[model samples]
Target chain A: MNKGGAFFGVGYLLGLFVALVAFWLAMSGLMKPLLLSLGAVSVAITLFLAMRLDVVDKESAPYLRWPVFIGYWFWLMGEIIKANWRVIRACLRADLDINPALVKVKTRCKSDLAKTTFANSITLTPGTVTLSVEGDKLLVHALYEQDAEPGAFDDMDRRTAAAAEGAPA
Target chain B: MEIWEAFLANFHAWRPWAGALLCVLGAVLVVIGTVGVVRFPDFYTRMHAASVTDTSGATSLLLGMGLMSPDLVTVFKLAAIWVFLFLTGPTATHAIANAAHVAGMQPVTGARARGDVGEREGD
Candidate 1:
């Protein structure tokens, strides 16, 4: 097959795989017939465009270390569940008792990606929001003023830095 | 098939009210999350708003829908959506935060500043 056709063939199969997965899940079976038919033409065009696009640097890809990312994600989930429970309890009580404020935390992680991941993880958890991120410093807004304590945010920062360190980069 | 029919046939007796209540609660949570997103001062805080909506609001909606439908397929779809949200939501937020950090956004400080070890460490 010609090089053009070769790339298109790969893209076509990818789209087909996506369509089948969606169908088996029963979420979008209705689109299967249409997708399967148009998949070839669309995939060809997509591949053509993809071959020409060169926006992001390859080095940035190293930050996406799946194993470490998975561990961090699971840890984040546990924190979210815990925070949700706390929020539910607080919401139920007669006293809202929220001392909302923003606090700053710093990290040793040299990579910007690591610091960002940390800030985002904090945002994912309940009762805490990331207000800003400048360099290695992160400003976190917590539902309870006490939660914004330096110790708390710093602990989170350290965990994120560890996850980043464990990443491929 | 008859058992399945029986289940579906009887769904109307309880499903509607359950679905309505769950949906309302989900809507409320999602609204609150959106409010937080708009009210929060920065991107990091905004992530909190998005996460609450995904976990609390979206979870409530999915659970409510699953309860309304006892079918295996519907339940599976609901579970899948929950799982997908659980997996990707944080990752996306992390990506955004990383972008912000690289762009030079700084974090806010609180009254208990001395406790921050980074400051003492000369970071």
Candidate 2:
């Protein structure tokens, strides 16, 4: 995880605070004054600890680009549905016609967050699994060889880089 | 106008049936995934089969539960479960695959992965 540096601005802290508070409220669903005070205290303690730990950075709180992330998530979900259909068919086919292969895919993501987002998205899609990530190279196992062809992940990689690292789309 | 009015009036009545249908669909997907796991040739391929259950199957079930939920709190909880599952499922799968790779396990690939190879040598 990227720690505090030039990206560790007050905005990130505020964003984290807001997210934590919203999460707490939604999980608890309690508006009582006593419960509210306890929640506030916990949230304050967490924020203080985060500041002391020097982890309040853009990577930690990247909500500024939530719109892009949300859009990418919808696209990813569609990809997942499509991939699921393919895998489901492979699962049901009596012939076992799958041609599984291990392929190394190169990604253009610079930051750890972007790389991780790309890798996780690949793994989340049913047909492909990322075994390991070495620098810009990811060792991917595919249920079907075609799924892991050289340019297969290009679209997802570009979207991930753009969404998580603010790279040019 | 009448059709829209009927749909609006019966929206609540349809919720349970829709929720049940989604749940059944999810169960079927999970069962098919289980079948895939048993039939797939290699560890890597089995993981793919398992993921179908983890992703779409679980998603369908969770969406159904959310729709059937009596209160917003329950829906929120289900959403939280979904977010956490989405985050963790793939990570866990990757970890297992990485471990297998590190242990010198070779996945069957290419033409060899076709139906003839019944048992993996040193599983």
Candidate 3:
């Protein structure tokens, strides 16, 4: 069981390395000489730190399917942008119908990483905030009463859990 | 009436002064937020102060600078900073609040919680 965690961490590490390399290369091309040097140095330092640090013990990390997780994030970003627009519009209305309340919900994920990701995602979306996480449950506060509908919260858990199904934690 | 109109026109014409005023407004908000953080009784309240300062200060200063300078890069940087703060501010506050709650620090309430959100009596 623990071996699975390490496998996932290694996978995540590789993904991070690739992204950083691409970012560094892009910066070198677009930026001035001094800026490019600084960026290169920063990237080098970051890679050094990441590689040297024993942060990912692997025994307790969560696994995620990279492609699926990327897709999940893209979808979530769209939702967040749309939600923020709605919140802004609602806030500017003459009579604000804000009904701020915190409610508890269950996380379908078995891993700590998935639970934390779910909680953070809830807070990232506009008008919905994660107030607390106790065990596998989350206490979330929504701007409107309707925003707290159980189905909406449950949907996030299901989607995130599905994304992490094959990934090792 | 004509004299008043001239005075208003003069005020508007002093663009730099207006920009300075906006900058001052932003600074004042940040100071007030810092004071609130120091004086507030709890972590949650402190976070509220931080968020208010983060938005008000950054927005005000950036607006002031952008208004003063017509340079494209400077304006872009200011806008970028504002956008970054908007994305991170509330998220940081939420993270702190969640951590404190999980650690079992109940939010201060009633007479102690100053500016506390009122709770219903029945619930």
Tell me the TM-score of chain B in each candidate: 0.74, 0.92, 0.76
In candidate 1, what are the lDDT values of residues A41-123, reduced to their tens digit?
Answer: 66556545644553122223333466876776777767777887665554444433444566677767777777767766776
Off by over 4 Å in 2: A1-9, A48-54, B116-118, B121-123
Candidate with more favorable, higher DockQ: 1 or 2: 2
TM-score of each: 0.56, 0.91, 0.54
TM-score of 3: 0.54
TM-score of chain B of 3: 0.76
- Residue-level lDDT of model 1, residues B1-123, one tens digit each, is 999999889877878678879989999888777766655444544565567787888988988898888576788788888878865876776667666766766543343321332132213
Sort by DockQ, top down from the best: 2, 1, 3
Better of 2 and 3 by TM-score: 2
The complex in candidate 3 yields a DockQ of 0.09
- The models' CA-based lDDT, in order, is 0.64, 0.91, 0.64
Stretches of candidate 3 exceeding 4 Å from the true structure: A1-17, A30-44, A56-64, A167-169, B1-91, B99-123
**Per-residue lDDT for A1-169 in model 2, tens only?**
2445445577788778998999999989989999999999999999999988977877766767889999999999999999999999999987888999999999999998899899999999999999999999999999999998889999999999999988889
- Model 1 lDDT, residue A105, Cα: 76
lDDT of 3 by residue, A61-127 (tens): 3343567877887887677656655554443444534444556888888776677667767766765
Off by over 4 Å in 1: A1-34, A44-64, A167-169, B1-51, B63-123
Count of steric clashes across candidates, in order = 14, 0, 8
Clash list (residue pairs), candidate 3: A6-A58, A61-A169, A62-A168, A62-A169, A63-A167, A63-A168, A63-A169, A64-A167
DockQ of each candidate, alpha-carbon based: 0.18, 0.84, 0.09
True contacts kept of each: 0.22, 0.86, 0.12
